[model samples]
Target chain A: MADELLEVTDLTMRFGGLRAVDALSFVARRGEITAVIGPNGAGKTTVFNCITGFYRPTGGGVLLTHADGARFALQRLPGHRIARRARVARTFQNIRLFAGMTVLENLLVAQHNTLMAATGFGILAVLGLSRYPVAERQAIERAREWLDAIGLTERADDPAGALPYGAQRRLEIARAMCIDPVLLCLDEPAAGLNPRESDELNRLLLRIRADGCSILLIEHDMGVVMRISDHIIVLDHGRKISDGTPEQVRADPHVIAAYLGEGDEDEVPAEEVVA
Target chain B: MKSALRDAVLSALVALRPVPVAIAVAAVFVGRLLLLAWRGRSRAAARHANRAFAERLTQAGKYVAPLLLIVALAVPLSGDRYYLHLGILVMTYVMLGWGLNIVVGLAGLLDLGYVAFYAVGAYSYAIISTTYGLGFWTCLPIAGILAAIWGIMLGFPVLRLRGDYLAIVTLAFGEIIRIVITNWVSLTNGPNGISGIPRPTLFGLKFTPAGGPGSFSDFFHLPPSPTWRAVYLYYVILVLALLTNWVTLRLRRLPLGRAWEALREDEVACRSLGINVTVTKLTAFAIGALFGGFAGAFFATRQAFVSPESFTFIESAIVLSIVVLGGLGSQLGVALAALVMIGGFEVFRALADYRMLVFGAALVLIMVLRPRGLVAGRTPTVALGRKREISAELVAQGRG
Candidate 1:
């Protein structure tokens, strides 16, 4: 727990009479890959939203303690502040890239708050009497580095909406990187990817983990969870059913029942996880 | 004697005596393009191409303004009464377009009652100048102040709505202003309007013979012509148009300007970003209305007459059409669109009855062709900074 970058305790959300997430809690440790997997509508996304400052959970708190010793209550921040101020970034389930904007612009916009902070005093900088130029240069440099890192330097001027689904997914990740997050939260980054794109995604996630930034991912693909996740959490009907290592989680009776058929869990033979 | 000065100012502007002023503005843009090109020369070929496009755009932008200014001054100087009237009308719409750009283009708020603010300005000046015997110069700011106050009042009720609802409500608010002005006859003289309103004097010199050495025509050794007065109003509005451009440009890069764009793109996103969307929207409305008011007051002083018939829904639509035709968010585009739309209308003065029909159809066609706009959503990306071109190979893969 002390090594954790994000800790959730008894998080619950009730939409009228429906309990979308029910008292779920888990810890995502620093410099490790944590994957949350469940069947469709198992509250995987609601958990992501609560952590990244989107939906306001009806109950419980999300406490994030960074490696630098700063602590934050993510629930208190709005989605924009969480992305811009708290340095917590996310990719969307339906892909919320600013479609009308160019691919390069999508990434630059993620650093909007930073550029704004430098230029908010405005005319002072235009008059050449402010620190805005320095800040602006830093933002451009950061955006350039991320674009290069993502290998998207070739299509910078193309519209994000025009990008094929797989590249759009990667561009969203690149945009998130431009925000320079301490914890990169992904909502089904593998959703629509072909096997090759999924492999690319796995490699990217590995590279991201190597950078010492923690990752919290929600995926339905069991193979992805087993191949990369250092820790795994499972959910069923908005309740946490299991939490453990990928091996331990696979062995858990409840998770086995939830994924495969309940009684047929014993019939499974050993097989390697493919990305 | 007084009319002679007006004519001289008109002729000088037509000749574009200060060509250096035009050249200087051009040089700054040309210099920026060259710098961008030089930096990109050693970089990727893609970078060079993008920089070159930007360079051409900057050049086009620089050239467009001075050319317009030159044409504006030159056409009237030839003593072509027809062109003089056309130029004056062009200046008025240019003013309207600049003002509407603040509300719609920069702020992303669609204002339908923009002409109501124009009416407010005209009536404000008309009432004050006639009843109180006040000068036009004094009433200009007063009209702007009143229009801004009205803008705030309108902004309050429509602040929460977004997209279509906000537009409808604002449009209704404009209609309300027009209706009230039309119905209030005792003070305003209603539809019969106010006449015999005095034209503004150049210092102590009126357009008439009184306070002059002789009759205005005799002193100037020319016929008694209001063309002298028309030319003065044209230059006055010309300077005002330039002032409008400067102020709008400065405002667009401000915190408020960014907020407006943010709100336009995504209001929830904007609110989440800690921008007070309400304040930004209201500021756009107020600033935009203030300009409308300024143009309106100028109209009253120039024409020396006022009526409710001048400010109509069609007028508002035309102004909005000018903004949309130019570009959703481009200031220069709006100005050009205004010139073409309004100037073209005057060019077809013989077809005045069908001019509006053509304009209405043109608006629909522009929307159909570019749903986003002529310059749809294209901001100066330099505001963000240099971005690497995503590789074409990936784009091919993206298509896959």
Candidate 2:
């Protein structure tokens, strides 16, 4: 855990009587892909919300340590403060692209805080006296780079809602990337993709990981989970059931029992371990 | 066979209708031709073509303003007082629409209390000029600042509200302001309002009689006609309107402006991007109110009178309609909408009994045919190559 970018300890979230997330703990290492897989209603998303400050945890802490030795207690911060101050970014399960804005503007808006400061909170910029032009030029360059990586440079001027489903998912990732996040949390980035699109998503995630940004993904596809994840954690009924490297988690009896049938775990075949 | 079928259909229509067969046949032929014409071009293709045309128009935006300004300046040359006053009224509405556009169009705030800011500006000028004896130039900025302060005050409580709830609160705020002014007898003179407000001077020269040494007509060495003041008022409002347009255009390209648009699209997404949603919303209110203040000050000076009756809920509704009917976030659209809506009403003034009915019908037709307004698409603040128009179909409407 020396290079851990995010550490969750005993994170608990209670919605009235229902414990959506209970005592969940995990560490996401920098520059690596960490995936959380669980059955339906296992509260994988609740854990993400706790870490991203969308929901206040009933108990436990979420600690994020940056490369420069700075640390943030994400649980104590507001949602926007978590993203802005802690440099953590996330994509929604349902795509939340700025539908009225163009594909490029959506990415540009992600860098809003940076550009707003450069313009002296818009006073000097509106008057044409600030370094806003320089900042704007840099932002456009960065947006273009991301657009190229996502293969959406041609449709940069088109409205974001007009993009195809696969393209919108990629654009959401790109928009999240534009925030210059230290930890990128994607909620089912592969959710509605075809096999080919999922393969493309895998390549994109790998490239994003290679850029030294840690990725925390919540996905249901086991093929995607086993193929790309460097580390995997499984949860059941808001409890962390298994945590280890891919092979170890894949072979764990608890994970197999949770995936197959809870009582008939003995009937599982040896060959199914690879699945 | 086709002719037989058409004839049969025409005969059937004649039988069912208390109509002549000749008229039915003609109506059927026209309807079929129109349907075929419409079906000939795909909707997607038509939308793309319309967007391209809009793009070209926006590309020429720089020239459009100055050309309009030239025409405005040329209006007083015609020397028609009625037309001149109409132009001034239209310009006032245009300024009001532009101000509200910042809040409703860009920031996506549903503010029904926008006219409250306008009232603040007008009253600020009226009260100060009457009591303190300040000139128009001195009170203009002060009025704007005061209105902006009121804007921030109003913005604070509503920061947590959204959609219809936000709109209801704003509507209440507008009514509250009007009620307070009406009952505030000592300071505001109640329903009677403040009167005998000082008129603006042309560099310390009044537009009054030549008996005064530095009167405007004396300075120009022309016979003093009331048209001098009318023309002066026209130019002043024109300048003020242009300033409003200029500032709004500049802000649209600024970082704060983009934040407003982003917030409009999705507040949760905006906050997730680390944008200060509170500041964004407040600034929209303040800036929008600032312009409303300026326009208000001008209005008071032009009328030389102030009354609570002038600041009503209907004014807020009209301004809101201008922003919506102009297409959200489009400056040229707002101006054009103000002109068409306001100017259209003025042109039908001769048929005073039927004026409101005609106005209502036209508005209904606009809502049905162009629900997105005259110019619905927005040219992106930043883009590569030619900027593309974001179609109104892409936006969630009627909420704000």
Candidate with best lDDT: 2
Top-scoring candidate (DockQ):
2
Docking class of 2: medium
- Candidate 1: docking tier: incorrect
lDDT of 2 by residue, B1-400 (tens): 1122223223323343333344534555676578568957786786677667656666676587677678878999999998899999999999999999889888888887888999999999999999899999999999999999999999999998877778878878888988999999998999998899888898998987433578898887888888888899999998898888888889888778888888888888887788878888999999999999999999999999999989987788778777777777778878878888889988998976555555555654565456676677777888876786677778644243
Which tens-of-lDDT digit does each residue in B188-247 have in candidate 1? 999889998877766644666332454445556766676776676777888778778877
DockQ of each: 0.12, 0.74
TM-score of 2: 0.89
